[model samples]
Target: MSNVLLLFDKMGQRDIVTWNTMITQLVKTGDVDLAYKMFVEMPERNVRSWTAMISGFVQCGKPKEAISLFTKMEETCLKPNEVTVVAILAACADSGFLDLGSKIHESSDNNGFTRNTHICNTLIDMYIKCGCLEAALDVFEGMKEQTVVTYSAMIQGLAIHGQGEKSLKLFFEMIQTGMKPNGITFIGLLNACSHMGLTNEGLGFFTTMTNDYEIVPAIEHYGCMVDLFSRAGLLHEAHDFIKEMPIKPNAAIWGALLGGCKVHKNIEMAEVAMRHLQELDPFNDGYYVVLANIYSEAKRWEDAARVRKLMKNRGLNKTRAWSSIAVKGMVHEFVAGDDSHSLSMEIFEKWNELLVQMRLKGYVPNTSVILLDVDEMEKEKFLSRHSEKLALAFGLINTRPGETIRIFKNLRVCEDCHASFKLISEIVGREIVVRDRNRFHCFKNGTCSCSDYW
Candidate 1:
């Protein structure tokens, strides 16, 4: 490391390649801060130098800084190349800056970067991450030069956005185009089938993965299959699949089955999955929570309470749920009835107003999903104070008259919250999109795009 630094300092004249090599070395050695300092100190900067710095920042989990630097580079008359554009788009995607990503997409053609496959793939990924599946599809359709990477990007994007039919269509299209599907391609297809609950198709594809493509299923592939069968209420088949897995099942596999069991109220399977999960992850409270929910659904009050007691004894507490909304290019996060904000009183008042409107629209809270042993009124109050409601109230207060609100949650949106959002969408006469951990829920006119299936 010292030798490389000495060589870099001793160089009489530095070119773009020399600076790039030094920066790459520094980034590789985890000296991102020093590399960024050197980047600013350089008298002359080129596309490669800027790209290297941006990529380094992204690698170091500083995507916002990388994006800011990219903007600065553009302002300084340094015309971005294809590589630079791809790096910047990746930074935007990682940071969830959809508006900035759209601006980058508009500049691609004029900057002569549209023809590059890597840049196109990055653009597709950015649009997908921003929850703009239509834009992603448009970009995919316009790619005159499609490679395996391009096809995989489209497949993954479609799967992620819950457009399973379109994802499968593109899978067949890739085959017709004479491109062989790879491991990633199959993973995307399987995930799409899983999300769509296409059991037979998912099973057939899982078999084809090894028989036709000669590709061994990885743990993730198997996990998707487990999720597929378990989600379809085929608890026995899911159990057998996990038992017969080529690779030993991990916590993710058990977790998937446990989640399904909770949904189906399968106490037996939930117990089985929980046992394996406990062995795999002794300290994680997720398995315990799922088991408790299953017990609660089955009216096994003692068992449910026992699980909670075990969690407390093990010094494990439930993670505080949080939700976030993007407003004026800034993200605001809130916990359940969070009063720590400077405008807490205003937010609380707006929340009360929303509750009144929702109740007037005949919105009744579904308190069955709340596993806590609380009275009915307390449960209703707790449901109202959920993190999603807080974030939604914040969005309502901050956004203008006609703007749509988009929120993201770290966990599944509760049943009561989902109903409330439906009413909120109708009451405010605005479109609301909430991306939870599982899937996207677009609420408009008192209805969700998924028809409440999710």
Candidate 2:
């Protein structure tokens, strides 16, 4: 980025395109704060400039900032174009801001911009991301001319919601219309199958993707395959598949296999995955954490301790799990044992009440997943203060009883929390949707959408 800046200084005058390109690249590189610095220093702002910054903020996980930037852009003379609408819709999608997303759709209509395929597809994606599957279906049905991307978005939406069969049916419909599927389409299809444990169907789709469609498998495609096999406890097949891949497997591929190992408790395969992961990404704490967790799970105390010691020696620490909930356009963040909010006391009080209720509902903490060598009671205590639980407590305290509670978790929901949420959702008589790093878990009536599989 500094080299690009030096190149910029060499130019007598830089155009908006040059500035926008630099800003966009910086944002993509995870330097949004630096991108903002460049954005503010621009001589003049256009729709592109505002849109770039808004999109950058969203990509940086600052959806509220993106919306703020969009509002500021509206106050100016320039009307928001299709590109600007797509960026803001993405922000709305990431935050599950359905009401605000509707406003964006209406804004496009008011601006007299043509409802092109790109904008319409983005709308589909936004609705899906916000957990409004019916609304996404409505948008997909309303489109006049749909592209492969449109189908891909709809497929991904269904897949995430555990509607693998519906997504497959749609794939058939898409091909019947004589449109060839692309890499994105197959990724969505395979992911749908993977998440739903439709192993046979997923493998079938994988074969069809490469043999029939002639889409040379990308690393992402291989990752999905590994995930599908690994989640099914077929550790040997997944390992062999990784070895036989035409292209060399990367960290993501190994990570997917490792995740499966974690789920299936395959200590040997987890060790193999960790060895490759260490070579590929030496600084990533996740590999070490998972390897240690596998040892802890197996009651291999000395091995787990050694892994933790190695992590400390290498100056690597586990990433803190964080979660946030949006209520009435305001987002509240919570980390494990968090007490920083103004309603911290009230939140804990509500949490205590929840614990009593959870106990009455026969909730037993799953201590096997603690990953720490501690007493069972201490393990339970630590689990109670997890980020998702705190966020859920805060959501229950603030939101209406009948409203759906949506929380975003930065990591996979812990085993104990996942079990606890099942009871909490039934006891509270409200739908609770937790979007974790893996997939959306909609807890309703004492059951999770994952069906104890994930």
Candidate 3:
């Protein structure tokens, strides 16, 4: 990379291709900031240069910047080609920019990319990630041809959205089309079965995946199977399955079991899972947090304190949680107790008003999710200021009463927030769609699409 840079630097008459190559190479080498600098320093940029920079932003986890650059490109009236469209679409997906994503979908159609399978697949993914499952399905249904990638995205989308039965139906239909299910296909199948508690069916598919398809199980496949059994409340069986695995169980495999243990309130099994996790991934704060959460759930305050102390001793800090909501094509983000937004006062006031109404609707704050050793009132206050709740309040303040509120969270939704969201949705008479770390939670009329299962 240094040599290439040096050679490019020595070139006296660098053209657009040379500049684009250097920027693309820098992006490929994980120097997105440098690439952006070069992009800015360029005498002028063609579509390729803009595309490269946008793609770099997406790759480097700067989706908002990618969206910003794409907007600038649009202002220039330089039509994006397929590559630019795909790159920016990915940014839209990552940042939950559904409004921009929908616009791109229309642009793609006008630009004669509707039949482009790759773009269509990306469209499906963008819609799914944006918590628009029906839109994703619409894109899938409108496709003239579906690849394994397309099928995989749709299947996973359905599974995560709590449409396990429909996901399985799609898989069977895929089989009828003679497309041949791959490892990814089976993973999606296993996830569907896991989410819906189709234990025997999941096992059957696992067996068939190996014997009939000759696909060797990767760590992900093994992880999915463990998740299946663990989610099904078969902790002992999941343990035995891990023991019998041909390869060593990774942190994800053990973590899946721990997650199930938390869901089922199996402290003994949760400890067992933690013992392995400590060895496999001791530094991962998520594992320690989960164990602490389990102890808190069981009212083992001392044990929870001990786990937290252990984390402190190991110099581990809990991952900061945040949630985002997009309004008027601009994304607004909130952290726990965040007060930095311009509408902070309004957000707090709106939430206070909603809480009064929510309480009237029989909403009692479940303070258990807060592991802190504080008074119940303090704990409830802390819970009320959670990032997602702030985002929800902000959304309610900014949007019309009947408008749907969509949010994206960086971590799993807490039990307290999940329960409160159901009541809040009912009180507000609007659909609240939240895409969290685990899955989609669409709350409407006092029920979640996940059926409170996720």
> Top model by lDDT, which number?
3
Candidate 2 residues lying further than 4 Å off, grouped into runs, are: 1-35, 42-44, 58-64, 75-78, 95-99, 112-114
What C-alpha lDDT, on a 0 to 100 scale, does residue 235 get in candidate 1? Answer: 90
| Model 2: per-residue Cα lDDT over 58-105, one tens digit each | 888898899888878878878877888888999988877777788888
Clash count, predicted structure 3: 0
Model 2 clash pairs are none
Error of 2 at 88 (Å): 1.4
CA RMSD, predictions in order: 3.3, 2.8, 1.4
lDDT (C-alpha, whole model) for all candidates: 0.84, 0.87, 0.93
Q: Candidate 3, clashing residue pairs?
A: none
Cα lDDT tens digits, model 1, 1-454, are 8988898889899887778888889998889999998888888878888989998998898988998898888898988777778888888776667778888899897776888778888999988776677788888889889898889888977776667888999999889988899988988998888778899999999999899999989998999999999888899999999999978999999999998887788888888888888899989986787788888877789999999999999999877789877678776788875789777787789988988888888877798978777898998878878888888888889999767787878788888898888888988998887778776777889997556655
lDDT for 114 (candidate 1)? 82
- Candidate 3: regions farther than 4 A off: none
Clashes of each: 0, 0, 0
lDDT of 3 by residue, 1-454 (tens): 9999889889999999999999999999999999999999999899999999999999999999999999999999999999998999999999999999999999899989988999999999999999999999999999999999999999999999889999999998998999988999888899988888899999999999989999999999999999999988999999999999999999999999999999899999999999999999999999999999999888899999999999999999999999999999789899997889898999889889988998898888888788877899999889989999999999998899899999999999998899889999999899999999988999999999888777
Error of 2 at 87 (Å): 1.2
